[model samples]
Target: MERDIIEELGSLALATRLKNLSERLAKDVSQIYKESELDFEPRWFTLVYALKEGEELAVTELSSMLKQTHPAINQVANVLVANKLVNERKDEADQRKRLLRLSTKGEKLVSHMSDLWGQIKKANDELLDESGGILLESLDKVEEALDNKSMYERIRSFQA
Candidate 1:
């Protein structure tokens, strides 16, 4: 097997390692979406699912829900809009604000994919079990730690 420079870097390369893992999983998920004849990107899953319950929401709301930046939410929401899966409307009380709602197409897609979603969850659970079933819990702790004390803050404190 080839040597892994990122692995050799250990804790210093944690971000890269996680990113690589994410990309690999995304590739497989993207393939699944394609095979299903769905024109959705793996990245769009969260946003689409968020809108599946028939509530009008803003990009800001989606960002908060996904723990992502507003720009990221805007980018994904724009793609969903362009795909005709979501509709945008002026917020009734706030003229300058736009709210998003799932179109009939999006609702139908969500309904159609319900079974596939379950299978995907089962596959993901199996993958988690293969990895000892604690990765997600550990990730939650790491994210909480970061929220309480950011890496930059920790580095600065160490230098001080």
Candidate 2:
């Protein structure tokens, strides 16, 4: 009976439902990008969006905000600078420190993307009901539990 319950929890029906939802969300986001005519990948958008709200952030600060490494942030910043979407300037207080800010073009692109996201949110609202909120809350709990469980902790307290 226990084996059967476990199998039911991992059934193909549940897998298909999760895959379908992911595919739908991806399609919606892709459509929004196509409409904006913005050639940025998702990671680029994340950085650009962060800069849209402010001006001039140090590379290390940006990396911490994005939860990414310095090298990764630098690589993306270099591409943006080369494309003229962002500008890097030397800090006045510290000549050795470089600060990053979005250029005029980048600012416009981020504004357009924000509008597109609003539209996506409206569409999603139409598709989801009150049950959706409950499901999301449950999923959040599961994710939190998983995040708190380290591999070492799991091995030391193995029950299964």
Candidate 3:
């Protein structure tokens, strides 16, 4: 077997490695959705989940709750609206603010997809268990560490 350079690079290639893994996982999930005849993207899960819980929420609120950027939230929201799975409107009291909620179609799809989501969860748990079971915890620690001090900051400090 050929030695994988990315794996060998370890933390030096953390971003690449993680991205590769993420893309692979996304492809698999997309395949699952395709097989099930669902018109959904793996990226849409977070926004959908947030809207599901919050019912009707402002774009800023969804951004904060999802820990994603306003632009990111807006991009997904637009896609959802275009797909007819979500409804978008201006806040009546604040015309400048955009509001979002699942369309009836979205609600129906959610109910239909609940079981498939459970299966995906179970599969992910098993995969995590197989991979030493601490990846998520380690990722959380890494995220918090980066939040306290970004990679750019840490890198620049080396020259001091």
Candidate with top TM-score is 1
Put the candidates in lDDT order, highest first: 3, 1, 2
Q: Rank the candidates by TM-score, best first.
A: 1, 3, 2
Off by over 4 Å in 1: none
Error of 2 at 33 (Å): 1.3
Residue 40 in model 1: shift from native, Å?
1.1
Per-candidate TM-score against the hidden true structure: 0.94, 0.60, 0.92
Model 3 per-residue lDDT at 96? 86
Candidate 1 TM-score, true structure as reference? 0.94
Off by over 4 Å in 3: 1-3
**Candidate 1 on 117-156: residue-level lDDT in tens?**
8988999999999989999999999999999999999999
Pairs that collide in candidate 1 are none
* Model 1: worst 10 consecutive residues (lDDT sum): 89-98
RMSD of each: 1.3, 5.9, 1.5
Residues 1-160, model 2: lDDT tens digits: 3366445667546556677678777776776677778666655756887799866899988888886889999999999999898999988999988799999888877776787767767776766654465766676776577669954576689765
> Which ten residues in a row are the worst by lDDT in model 3?
46-55
lDDT of 3 by residue, 1-160 (tens): 9999987888999899889999999999999999999989999998998877538999999898988999999999999999998999999899989999999999888888899999999999999999999999998999899989999999999988
For candidate 1, give the lDDT: 0.90
Candidate 2 weakest lDDT stretch, 10 residues: 1-10
- Distance from true position, residue 157, model 3, in Å? 1.9
